[model samples]
Target: MSAVPAMPAVRVAEGPVRIALVGSPNSGKTTLFNALTGSSARVGNYAGVTVERREGVLTGSHGGVRILDLPGTYALDGETPDEHVVHEVLHGAVPGEPIPDALLVVADATTLRRSLALVHEALALGRPALVVLTMIDEVKARHGRLDPLALSRHLGVQVVGVVGHRGVGLDVLRGFLDDARNWRVARVPTGIADAGARFAWVDRVVHEIGADVLAADTRSDKIDRLLLHPVAGVVVFAAVMVLLFQSIFAWAVPAMDAIDTLFALAADGVRATLPESWLVGLLADGVIAGVGSVVIFLPQILILFTFLHLLQDVGYMARAAFVVDRVMGRVGLQGRSFVPLLSCFACAVPGIMATRTIASPRERLATILVAPFMTCSARLPVYTLLIAAFVPATSVGPVGLQGLVMLGLYVLGATVALTAAKILNSTLLRGRVSVFYMELPPYRWPTMRMLVRQVGQSARAFLRRAGTIILAASVVLWVLLHVPQAAPIAGATPAETARANLEASVAGRLGHAIEPVIAPLGFDWKVGVGLVASLAAREVIVSTLAQIYAVSEGESFRGVLEAIQADIDPRTGRPVFTLPVALALMVFFVFALQCTSTIAVMARETGGWRWPAFAFTSMLLLAWLGSFITYRLARFLA
Candidate 1:
């Protein structure tokens, strides 16, 4: 019953030899790929699709060979964009990609019976093949049976068993891969396309080899009973989220202060080394102070991403999604929509793109329209700045009041998003939702290496943005606030003179022009300036305000909180940013469509400017109304 053994090696294409890595989700394919090509991987979007393309050079002196990791798909016949792309890639139909020289079909050892059907599909492609069995350690620990020799014999492909996290069997896999000149195409059987025959072949192989894995692990089952409980699960998730926010404030304070101190010294050093002039002012007040203010929030950002990655790696995120699916249905969204919204907390561009998984256009459109309401990482800088300056640090029971405010803002965004989706479902995008399905991955211990790598990537991305967009905006804002310098008053101090110059300059004039409209929300000209500048990017406001305060204060950077708190209004003879004003500012940011990149992506996803325009119009009005209510209510209560 076995297929024929390998023939002589076929010649690969002239340039770099490409191997396509294919698998179903939770099959340990990502872990295997990461082990095979640690830091050399490159990630980008495919030519015409937003699906992420990840490829990397093979390790162990395999000079020019590249391994491309395709999106995880259960079957080639599925309707999802991921499945379509996989089929296109296999047939060399994609524009920018060539047909792969070989196919590496990865399978979870514990789920081999379910994976054999995918292997059959791969063999039908008539490409050179190497089958990898991941989670082999788990199989052995469960006292299950596996015979790689017999499985390869039946399938007519080379087979290797590996424990990806422990780096077991990797050397052998690499050596086999290094012999690319010797790779042989797998033998394809007759009637391979028949679904019944394909599945029957899988069943026979399992029965003959006794390869069915042990029933789901006892330990995982025991844990799932508690975490998957309808009632207890939500309570535990809520508690975990509260602690995550609390740690962001309590854990990051030392690092944020250190960064602030370092930048202050750097700015002061530049001012002392060079004589006082426009150049010195630009370097000290604009570039250093502006960039430093946003960069100081890096510690908090790192903490946030760490919690996210840890939860994902430990296999808890899927459980959370499962728990939320019930609530999602009440809002008329499919269970598949939960993953995209969950991703929105990181950024909306990818979240909107993820809607391709929903086969129903109406459901997908509704998810896209409301995706911006999720509190993204870009909003963290604004929220942290206002909360630290205005919210007291007193502990409310076990949680700090600052942490409570952060959590409330996040909850507010999500609550509004669901409400909006419910309305959209009932009106503009009315339709029946498709059937929903999700797999809960088994719990595993998170590796420190993966966690560190992910956090490092996040930190680098944040720093890159600071060096580019924020840096440019800071310089421009400096010029607008400094040009046409005011004549020094008779008895004015240096700070007073600088403050007066800023009020008379271009930026100050622009802020004042819009100040009348925002006055009802308790904002002054400086906040007006920040709000206008933030439209470019949500985090830009943090830098904008830092530059405004730096020149107005005419002193070294003494932490953004201290500088913002020191501002006193000449007309009112009182502090500018009181509790009401600060709370209003936070509420405004929660609803604003402040990032242009998000708008552009929305246009791309919706296939025109119409939906993006509508979303912007609605959110803008909501932000203003939300801010007004918050400001007036807070003032009245005070």
Candidate 2:
């Protein structure tokens, strides 16, 4: 072991010091950031590469400190977008952002050697820096003990140990931050020709601080034996996913029913209080039915988010990526693409954003283009509505048939995405495939505080969308379906009058115009209207259907679904929304690129209209074809 070096005395910068929190992914840097600043910035066990940079004020007995949580990067080299963002931020190249006054390089204590290479890169920048060793408990559990003071001496910099999640050693860490004047640049080896030199230097530091913890068979390793086995890993992964989607149905039933009952009560209240006029129609049929239809899915979204957060916190997500690497590689996508694609189940906008972590532009573009094919939370309402209406809630062995259908839809989307990626890699975006590399962090017990925060953030985002875009779309759709009210016939009932009014509305006319194009897929003019309205968001499809039927049938959501089930086609004198038609609608939604937010994100990510336009056109065509085939096949089977 080498002798520890003495730290040179230095003066801390005056005024508020801007410190950039840099670390490798999953190093607990964000956890430390949250602890120091008391911000609820999202934390994930997997590499959260797409999360935007966040800033917060760290206030303590030492006054206020400005802390910028930079994106996690394995190196300062600009190889990936995350690294580039961190690099630019550190260099003050990003406009309106100052160069950091100092660097807080956080390292995973258990994986100290892997983290030190980046720490070395930071030191080369000639900035006053301090090392914060996080996950000290994990290190100790692995029979490792780190003396931060000794390590600081050996590295010629200040060092502190913190268990960010448990809030241990945080006050001491803060006290070190307060004494920023004593912080000094680390004396790392210069002229590192290759990674070998970096590892050698890291080994020396580890030995000097007595942080070379003895290896032992632990719980994670024991679990990984089964979870990482080729056959068992894949089976467990599939089973986990099936249960996740199944829980979306099983767990959310009570919450969904409650939301539905509440909305029904609100509608009944409005009907009783308001006069029989357009105002009443708007409030009962338009606003309540439209918004409530989409809002009811909030429970399922939250549940899905909860499962995702739990899996991430427990460090299963990275293993999932590893398990699927071979399968993904066959489709020209690296294992890293799995995380972003998995994120697509929540929404594609963020998934597309997450492609930034992919090092190769061709691979990233390919991933972005196909990300929307994964069934997002926005599609949940439509899927749930159709499956409930058409698919029987019976058991396929232990699994509910409806749940299987939902899982099938998700699987179908992923399959299509992978197929599309394969095609793109062979043709338009063809390039050499990049090798996937990821570190599997040790699993830890998920904390209640972190889980609640994650669930709350997702719930807030979902509600915000419901309040803004969904609300606005519902109102606009209401006006479209209600205006140009027909002159009343003397003997006509209120329902008849409402139906006539909808038939004469502008929305009806547009729907009629598009009906011919969609007829092959078993959709009528009304369904056509919904497909059009939902271009703003996929969830709007359910709301639009509710609004359309509410005006025409003057019914509740269940009533509307029942009415559709019994609807007679005027020409054929047969039921509309038959099993075939319902299945076709699901297929269409599964393939359609209808969400404007997703399109906008794709456009921004691809840096042009060309690719997004191509995506929209291709997806639209695929949706039409898929729906046509599904309708024909289902009709034949029926």
Candidate 3:
């Protein structure tokens, strides 16, 4: 027999009773949220140990409740925007936001004194606070004792032990949710509210509890013994990164190839069925070809996210930041900058936003300004198309030679970004280096659910950007390259060959006029056309090139590659994209801030266009200079 569902619970003036999970960095607050809400939360340490907020709804055995995973903060008495939000929400200060009815103070059992600082601070507000002792399993195995009941009594709130990842304490926490009266505000003396005084009181509470709390196992120390070794750690880190790149290519290649093949077949079907005409060509080449070209890269992107998701889920990502901290510090960045900087390897927008955790505005802005120098996954389509066509995969010892080149490009982008950040720090956005401090979460096996969710979220984000920006850009590029139809010459190919007539169109004429400016850069009129086309979106460079070379036909990668390889400059009779030019092109992409979305986001986040404008102009200058040097040097070397 079906059981009747519980009736709705009492609603506050704010609509629903809102509970926020608050804690110190790496206190497993998000993990608890995932457990309570059955949410597939994407957990990662943001900008070292500073926390970022996330929210989910929990409606299970307990009545429905909205759960906010507030950023893990050390204390709530700050003017920092994140901390301020927490304070305002608790005091009903933020307009249009719900005032939290209950505060679930997640505390790490292994480090009770440090964890309790926030709880003690929260209690001062006289709000209903419940202490959720997190990581009880780790605490018991390593620390040797924890008296949750005693700790609760001392703090004047109900405390529950939770092994969040393993799904413990949900029932206990939920039970307390039904009876708000059990919680009370503790009034502590102002003298005892000093940092040292508060810590002293917390220490006394643990001491009085005797030896029931188990200590946290020194697993981190043991693991760090090898993973943190200077030479070995760097070696292992490099090996891990190489494997990630390989996995991205190997695991996703088949699906990407299948996507390409399906689209190619679809184009063929359209060509065979419809009579040769401009409308048929636009439908097949302009619409189908343009969208499919971008979509084909999604599988590889999803694959990359899967590996990143696992690393983050298993808690090695924090260590990765620690290991890279020294290198990052040279550029006025913290160890926490590692995840976001590394994330920029996938896309700059997320990487830029990820810098929010950096407390220092100058450091964060510098990080943001230089972030686009890191090659994003969007560049992959361009790189793969070019590299496979141009760079040979000769045997390099035991590794795939092409893979090493791909790895070099990635490393090159990072190196450039780091150097750029250092330059920006010293010249434009100088600031004091932020000291690195972050808690390493206990290592755990990644759940499939977590990996799938993270990967899906990343892929969805990538596709969404492509759909909005790239999609619109592609349509505009297609029209620019195709419309304002060039009047057919008396004896030129028929008007049906619209592509041949494109050279006389508005876009083509503009490309011709600007051709001389970039000619020394080894760009011909068609390549200039591509550069213009790319202003809409970078990947469109591939499709534009495809159209330029296959104008008589449509979009074909092989056809474009062959044309590029064979084409001679009309003025110099030299190859248009010589090795020098290709290298220069790669260098330009490394430094250029090409995405409009990144600029808009930077403007909004910084609350003005000044930063974005500065970023754009500075990056464009760097890109031009870098590309020029690369071209001239490569030519001189040859």
TM-score of each: 0.80, 0.81, 0.83
Better of 1 and 3 by lDDT: 1
The reply for model 3, stretches above 4 Å from the true place, is 1-14, 39-53, 61-64, 178-183, 187-193, 211-216, 265-291, 339-365, 376-412, 432-435, 488-496, 504-506, 551-555, 568-583, 595-613, 632-638
lDDT of 1 by residue, 1-638 (tens): 25755432334445677889999877888888888888888876676454567899887655577899998877877665566788899999999798888888999888887888887788777788889999888887778889898888877889999988889999989987776545667775756657788888888888888886576687788888999777888898777756765676688789988998999899999999999999999999789977886687678768767876787788886786677767788998876677677667766655675576554456677888899999977798889888888899999999999999999999999999999999988987765334456777778999999899877866775577678766777787678878878878998767667767777788778889999989999998899878877775687677667656744443323456787788899998999999899999999998988866567667766667888899998998899999999999999999
lDDT of 2 by residue, 382-430 (tens): 8888888889889989999999999899899999999999999999876
RMSD of each: 6.4, 6.8, 6.2
Best by TM-score: 3
Per-residue CA lDDT of model 3 for 49-98, tens digit only, reads 23355666664634356677876678887645556667766777756656
| Poorly placed runs, candidate 1 (over 4 Å) | 1-12, 190-197, 230-232, 332-411, 421-435, 483-492, 515-526, 534-586, 595-618, 628-638
Candidate 3: 10-residue stretch with minimal lDDT? 42-51
Clash totals in order: 0, 0, 16
- Which number leads on lDDT? 1
TM-score of 3: 0.83
Considering TM-score, where higher is better, how would the candidates rank from best to worst?
A: 3, 2, 1
